[model samples]
Target: QVSSGDSSVVIDKKKDRRIRPSVVVAALRAAQQREPKFKHEAFIESLALAYDFVIASKSMRPGAAVKLLDVYNVLTIMPGSAREYTRPEFARDIYLLDQSGHVTTKKGRKMSLPASALTRSGGVLRTVTRNGQAKDYAGISFEEPGA
Candidate 1:
């Protein structure tokens, strides 16, 4: 069995290139068993590597950091270098998504938070009164255990 760590390497055989679904499932199961000890991103990254998935990036360190941040409910689908759009609506939506725990940015990576995290982070909404009044409200913040 291959040990789990940064220095570990997986050598795939060209003759037996068939992907074993069971191995992938087993890796995921093992990861799930250790879920409590890992953040969402760490769990996924560990499982992905356990199944021999290659994380493409400049270096393994950054790749791991990106993966770790992913478990924290940050979405980095769109790169920071993405072209800036002047539309207020689009900008507002992205900001709302970022604030609502749906997405988070760190070190140039976008990560998605689990639904449980999203619900816990609180919802974002704008209230408008019929009497031509509008108010912006911030949602309650949920602190993680030991946070």
Candidate 2:
């Protein structure tokens, strides 16, 4: 029998339970079916969509920020949406950017970007928090992606 945290199983004279390759493949297939396919465009679209909301918020309050969790919530709650931004792979995609760009997730009561970030014309994107918790506020001031 398999034991938790143990990679090797103790085989007895009467018990021989070996996992087959077919079993592994079947299990992987099932998991793949249950999860949404990772698409770069979909991930980018989600960010862009969240950026729109951030822009609106900034218009109301200068230097306002938004939470990444809020962006994930918005993407998942859309009607007829199939993209799953909650998946670790999808989430990791956001963290992939050029040297000049970065996404920050911090726990604090206040969130702000550096003044130098503002000079980019394309503002930096960051998630805001309050009381050391994420809030529904992602800050955006950067140029659109690919612009």
Candidate 3:
């Protein structure tokens, strides 16, 4: 299968037959579902196929960002009355930076990352919840795992 700008092709060399249009559509749909973040145009460009023999060409959706995890182990959720620290809005959005240097916006997703996920430099911005109230514990320490 090959796709170019506004064009695509599926070569069946064994039979030298063109793939059925419906099958092609199904395959593309499956591809998108399996990996929505894959760039459609880039896939076509990688194939380096000509459009003159393209059996099908349809507008494909751009890659979508998938939410995974958030950075910063703590967030300040206090309304107004701020000091100099991470903003409260940072608590609302889970900022996940993938290995590929791409960020995924995870709105409405709470940052429930494990303590091990954090580092001296980064992790999910966290605040301890006590008595149904959240409190910032900037200079506190918890027992290490198996320690």
lDDT of 1: 0.32
Could you estimate the TM-score for every candidate? 0.19, 0.34, 0.18
Cα lDDT tens digits, model 1, 75-139, are: 22355512232222222333334445532222223343223333344443343332334433332
Off by over 4 Å in 3: 1-18, 36-101, 104-147
Which numbered prediction scores highest in lDDT against the true structure? 2
- Encode model 3's per-residue lDDT on 46-92: one tens digit a residue: 21221111212222221211111221222222464234334342332
36-134 in candidate 2: lDDT tens per residue?
A: 334544445456556557557546342344444445555667664524333333233443321114332221112232334233443234322222332
Q: In what order do the candidates fall by TM-score, top score first?
A: 2, 1, 3
lDDT of each: 0.32, 0.39, 0.29
Better of 2 and 3 by TM-score: 2
Error of 2 at 20 (Å): 12
The reply for model 2, stretches above 4 Å from the true place, is 1-42, 54-63, 79-83, 98-147
